[model samples]
Target: MTAAPALAPAALRVRGVTKSFGDLAVLRGVDLEVARGSILALLGSNGAGKTTLVRILATLLAADAGTAEVDGHDVAAEAPQVRESLSLTGQFAAVDEVLTGRENLILVARLRHLPRPAAVADAMLERFALTAAGRRRAGTYSGGMRRRLDIAMSLVGDPPVIVLDEPTTGLDPQSRLEVWRTIRELATGGTTVLLTTQHLDEAEQLADRIAILHEGRIVHTGTLAELRALLPAAPVEMVQKQPSLEDVFLALIGHDGPPATAPSGPTAQETAS
Candidate 1:
């Protein structure tokens, strides 16, 4: 029998990845693979160590055990290669407040040693719809605009793998949608993206594969269809009637309402003891 053709190298791979802080174990034998030219969403509640995992992948932190690779280069042994192939947007947008949006982009471009920093910065501002505000200080921009500039800075080197950690956290709905469109376009253009987000809808919309990180370990990983199929189907409620009080409340408050319910059973702490 003929063997199957060797699979193309994955964009990123983590095997038995584990991390700890003294007595506290954060990541416990987590294994994940993100394929080239796809979006992999890492979903979890706050304090689930999603950021920790991304840090390891981005070469910001060292794992206590197991192995990680980016673009066929071992993360530990080939740190520079991994860094060169990956871009990470931290949970908080990190634009320099003192710098104008254009200056920020140019600075990053220069750091990446782009041949023409001004041209590259101009192109990025145009691509991210920030050309209008490019001359303003990042501190003066709206949250969404600042976030967009922060993301634009990360693309200076055009890394193949982009790690976006909650890139849309403070954006308005329209801004969030715009970010989603940009993410989808990147994935379609053959860039692998690994993202961590609490927004389940965003994951369902953009991720080719979804991994639910529960207590640092991946409890679920699959395509949206596969993950959704695991749960009982519930009717999506869209009303032709006038907006309900809840909708009106959210509209007036400019925020999603309080969470609907609490966990039904014992907490993880109770379960562990």
Candidate 2:
């Protein structure tokens, strides 16, 4: 009989991840896993330590306690390997304003020592639908175009995992939707994406799984349906309701209606226990 094959490890893994500043604890024993080729959204409010957790995962900050691994490499002990396996696009677009979009990508590819950087850069520009704008300086690009270039730069390394920190925070509605489509395409193309977002609707539209971080810990981790299940069952009623302005706007823009249902079970604060 043939021996069974071993399963691949998760794209990202964290155990007992803790971080603090002086007397205040920002993260209290957080743990999570992101499967390969899946999208995981880390949902949190302001000052909920979402950014801090992302920084640690990207190897920008050291966790006071606990271990994190990316593509099977320990983040602390094998920083270079971890870096090689993941790319990070922070809240703000990080492209060089003076360089053309194409030049920015080529510069990143060359820095990563990729052969044929020009070819790689062109491919990325085309992939992100920035081919027309590729020749223009990043400083002249619109917010959406610059954001796409920023993400394209991250992909120049061809990393298996990508970390996006509130990527659409300040974008207009149309720009935000464009970025959302781009993110969905990334996951569909076999990239593991871990995104932090304050927008519940964004999480609902993009994530395969959602993890809620409150105070410091993940209070919930599941799909939209599972999260909805946590709420108390509503009584049957027959009532006609008119559509709200938000619903009309969503329909106009071809957006799916509504964010996740409100959770009446233990709140994130209650679930911290």
Candidate 3:
């Protein structure tokens, strides 16, 4: 009798993740989970320790006292497998400006030891709509195109999970939308994504579920509708204050610590550097 194939674990799983640098605590016992092929937007402002949390999940930085797993592999114990299962794109696109778009993709493919790097790059260029710009130096590409190419490079090995921290930070609205469409397509292909962004509308647009991180803790997490359900029933005068999400965030989270260390929430790596 043939044994049934084992079930794939949750695409991303994190529990009690805490990170501190000197006197500053960056993440305070964060607990979260993301299912396979879903997009979870981690919404937080500039000093909310979002980048610190991302680094921990990607194995780029270790947590002080907690465990995290990617694709069922423990992040700390199985760093190699965890990294292989996920690709990370930080606030800025990690592409070589001097290299042509094709060269950039091929370089990453080779780095990953994928066979036929040229073929892999070509496929990725096509997949990301960069085929027309394949031979152009990445620096010459527009903001959106460069970002797409960066993402294409990350996809060269088809990692099952992708971590994007502020992927649309500096893009025009149209460029932002273009990236949004690309993200949507990736999820459709069964790729799991954990995206960190401060933009409320972006969260509404791209996430299957939204998690709001405040002062090193997840204050709330749920589907857009589910999150909306947390609000008091509408009738402006009845509630008194405005119904903005900022209001809701503060309301749900309560008045916590002073939004983490100020001036853009530096991670331990940043401070050590």
Candidate 4:
């Protein structure tokens, strides 16, 4: 795809995207928009069709109805072009276990036909802070390191749009934080990101906006503050301010960055139908 999105004020646009299998419907009618260089979290629960919708946008699956576009390329008609404009990192780390971390990066670089794949791989390894583990088999790396390497590989071509589906689902607290930091850095560097998550705190911490997908439709769309306004503040009680788990976790780990404002729960709770 062309770099039109960078200067054309483009966005990841989805309109009435729907899908189904036999009699079971997945995405009924979903719509969302992630602006250029910003992060939008598609908040939902299991069976919410978030993955199905993502697959449609990624051109891995065809939609029964509606359309999706990125950087002026239609997902159906201009699939190849749309692909050029986007990068996808799924729910799990898509790394080669047998390959070393550096080798994994080099493999992706070569697939993208980047010049001097070794140099590109070296840069990626250093960027993800995996230089020391560059020679280690990816399967031997810690969960956080493996996730970082996966993300690093995804960014090789610097696709203007990226879709990450529950990137930190099974990670430990520290590893989750590391992946969170990486995602924030991605948006800060001007890549439009669309990520799906069940965690409310994740949406609060990462997204510029949140779209709560429920029963196959977007029931609400807004920033954390806006969504929080939907529910009245917790009675403004003069009660003790107990530190949250996230607060405790960060304090114990000394992690630097904005702490998530949301309490732990499925993101669907942040909004209602």
* Candidate number achieving the greatest lDDT relative to the actual structure: 2
Per-candidate TM equals 0.84, 0.88, 0.83, 0.88
Q: Compose the digit string of candidate 4's lDDT tens values, residues 75-177.
A: 9999998888888998889999999999998899889889999999998888888999999999998898999999999999878988999999799887898
Over 4 Å off, model 1: 1-5, 232-273
Q: Over all chains combined, what TM-score does candidate 4 have?
A: 0.88
Cα lDDT listed for each candidate: 0.85, 0.89, 0.86, 0.87
Which portions of model 3 show Cα errors greater than 4 Å? 1-8, 236-273
All-Cα superposition RMSD per candidate: 7.5, 5.8, 11.9, 5.6
Task: Tell me the tens digit of each residue's lDDT in model 1 across 1-273.
Answer: 999999998899999999999988999999999999999999999978899999999889999999999988899999999989999998778999999999999999888888999999999999888999999988998877877788888878888899999989877665565677788888888889998999987887788999999997999899988986897766454433444453565577665433112223333222111
Relative to the true structure, candidate 2 has a C-alpha RMSD (angstroms) of 5.8
Candidate 1 CA-lDDT value: 0.85
Off by over 4 Å in 4: 1-9, 246-273
lDDT at 113 for candidate 1? 85
